[model samples]
Target: MKDILVRSLTGVVFIALIIVGLTWNVWSAIAVMGLFVGLGLAEFYRIFQKENEGPERFTGITGGVLLFSGLCLTWLSWADQRIIWIPAVLGALPFVVMITELFRSKNNPIQNVSLSLFSWFYIVLPLFVLILLRGKANFPFEAIFPIGMLLIVWTNDTFAFLSGKFFGKTPLFPRLSPKKTWEGTVGGLLFSLLAGYLISYFSGLDLTFWLIAALIVAPAAIIGDLFESMMKRSLNIKDSGNILPGHGGILDRFDATFFAAPLFLILHFIYF
Candidate 1:
């Protein structure tokens, strides 16, 4: 009972922060996402450090923040999109890591470099894609896309958990996540579709587009959750961090967003 209360309270606070940040202004959205990227990267590096010994935490974080900031600046129109070369240069960070590793007498330089770069690709890049989604040209104030993305993801996660607890019998992926069930997955999908429709109606977006977005987001969110579960299973850890109390960590909370946001952006570009 106490755990449930703590989880509910934390969830309310988390949603409120995201709503205020995304709705307030472009800078606020960037600030909120910037914090997520930084902390997520930090968490990933910390996990990697447990096994890899030397993951170049400082340089990796610097490159990630640079990449994230560059993307945000360009997407928000605070900087010219042609300054793409800045991120282009920043993308060469892995090679720099390899070279830097040569100077150090580390036993697993390759492992360290690969893991550090993986943090950028896995955590930071998906977040950068989300920032791009917020700046979509059709959306005034750059609001609806990001907000809708969160709505669908959150709705799906909630329904999935509830349905699984009540009617879960057939495991969806017992190897990766034993608690997930096919029934839960379907419940989540239906709820996400409903939430998508509501968002479309309220935001005045096209119904077809929003429904399609739900279709993409629901499965992507499941994959995202399972992927994180796989990572934790491989690392033999329970939660990613202790930041969110009952919720585990930033990665645990936002895993669905990481995959859904990028896929939604892809679909948005292809369709919109």
Candidate 2:
């Protein structure tokens, strides 16, 4: 009972943070997303860190923040074309990481360099895509794209759990995630469509767009969750980090967003 309360409370707070971050203002959006990229990279490096040799955490996190924030600010066009050069600075970071690895004399220089660079691609890029999705042209201050996209994703996650708990039988992917089931996936999909319909009704956005987004987000979310699970299992770790109390880490919480945001952006570009 205590655990359930803690989980519920944490979940509510987590959702509130994301909504506020995305919907409030440009700075808030940058700050909140930066926190995720910074912390998620930290956790990623920390988990894989080795005694003799490991990823360069400082360089990795710093570079990731600059890259994410720069792209975000650039897309928002808050600073005009001058700030466009901000993202350009990240071009040197790969060389910087590689150079730093030379002094460390790690057991595996290749591992350190590769892993450090990989975080930018895996963690930072997806988030920047989300900011791009939110910063779509001429929609005013309202962040309907991100809010609606996340709503459908969250709805899918919620119902999938409930459905699986009650009616799950055939394993969706027992190897990657034992708890998931075909019944749950279908339940989540159906509910996600309902969530999309509600969003369309309330926000007056296109119904076809929301419905298609639900379809893309559900499977993408499932894949994201399973991929992260595979990563953790391979590393022999339980959770990404202990930052979010009952919810585990930022990486664990936003796994769905990592995949869903980028795919939705593709749809956005093609649609618009």
Candidate 3:
């Protein structure tokens, strides 16, 4: 319990610093996301390492570096068409795997190649969108992009856990996550919608945009939560890492954002 409190508080503080830094300058935000991309890629590769058949040593490190480099290089573009960079990066990852596999033919080449590809798409690519969206200058509600989304996600998680503990009756997906319930899902949706409205009111966002965001984000957040839960269960691990007491790891904490950010970015670009 003490560990949970300490970890939560520390997380809030660190996140607050990142938000402030991001709102202040685009470069600062990119730097922060770049670091996260690196860390997240490392975690993904580490998980793959546990498979024992994958290229655990050199390929894992290479995947991490490539993931980070892709994000960093995308920022150099002046146009918002930066998402186009992803396919190019995706194309290169396989070549990297094949080259490495030829030299080190001791391991299963197919598993090694697949692991490299999966890490890029599953972990790094989604995070790249967060940096791109947050760094956009023309977006009127620029300051709220990262912070508001973070707040909504955190609030949804808190309410879901509390409501589930007290009032849960029906399960949402018992196999994937035994603890998540319909009551929790309802609670999270309500909180997320409320959060969306609050951001609209406080951050000068249009009600239309907020409504759209809420509709889009609430479910994506839930999907993200379940996705990570599946990952944990697959690996037979309780948490992604013990770095944060209640939160688990960087992956656990940011799982919702990984899905939500990309969803929001797509909606923002397409609709607004």
Candidate 4:
């Protein structure tokens, strides 16, 4: 009970900060995202560290900085047409850094390269998406995209847990997540559908778009959750981190959003 209250309070504060920062100014929002990306990457690194195998600390730190820089460049690219150099800047910074890190080490080259590349994809790529969404033209919708993804994912997870506890019959993925069940999944999907409709109605998105998004969001949200569970099972870890009491970590809270947000951003790009 205490855990739930603490997590709920933390979630409220976090959302409040996002809304406040974005409404205040683009830079403020970017700064907030920078902090988010930084902390998120750090937590990911910590997870790797717990396993006794991770990228070189120096290289990882450099990657984190480059990721932040790339995000900033993405922001600048949106603010000006003549300033199209921003994407180029964003691309080159990480590429050069990763390449340099790769060549600097000759031992177990495959593992090192994988770690370097994976960090870029896992840690930095989403931040780049967040920056793009924030700065995209004709998409006042971008701001809502991340928030909507987060909300839907949260709803799915909550309902899935509750439904599974009360009415779970057949396990959905017994090998991966023994606790998940088809009943929970269906209930969660229904909740996500309702969430999508509500967000669309309130946010002025089209009904068809909302329905499509619901279809995409719910399954992806499940995949996101299951993927994290798989990773934890593989690593034999219980939680991603201890930052949020019962919530585990920011990663625990945002696991579904991590996948959902980028996919929703793509949906916005393609359809909205």
Question: Which prediction has the highest TM-score against the true structure?
Answer: 2
Instruction: State, as a TM-score between 0 and 1, how close model 4 is to the true structure.
Output: 0.85
TM-scores, each model vs. reference: 0.92, 0.94, 0.87, 0.85
Better of 2 and 4 by TM-score: 2
For 1-272, candidate 2 gives per-residue lDDT tens digits of 99899999999998899888888765777688888898999999988986645888888888888878767767777558667576667678789899888888778889889888888888999887767766744333467888898898899999998999999999999998999999999999999999999999998888999999999998898898999999899888889998888889988988888888889998989987
Off by over 4 Å in 2: 78-81, 136-141
Tens-digit lDDT track of model 4 for 1-272: 88779878887887788766554556776787777766776776677663345555566656666667765765666567875765666567546655765666555545655666676676667656666666544334547766666667777888988999999999999998999999999989899889889998899878777777878888888888888899788878888888766678767766776677788888889995
Q: What is the lDDT of candidate 3?
A: 0.75
Candidate order, lDDT descending: 2, 1, 3, 4
Residue-pair clashes per candidate, as listed?
0, 0, 0, 0
Q: Whole-model Cα lDDT per candidate? A: 0.85, 0.85, 0.75, 0.73
Q: Write the per-residue lDDT of candidate 3 for residues 16-133, one digit (tens) a residue.
A: 7667656866667667776776677666766656535656556656666666666566565646684786658746766877788777755577877776777667777776676676
The regions of model 4 sitting more than 4 angstroms off are: 50-52, 78-107, 136-142
* TM-score ranking from best candidate downward: 2, 1, 3, 4
Model 1 stretches with alpha carbons more than 4 Å out: 76-85, 136-141
Output the TM-score of candidate 1: 0.92
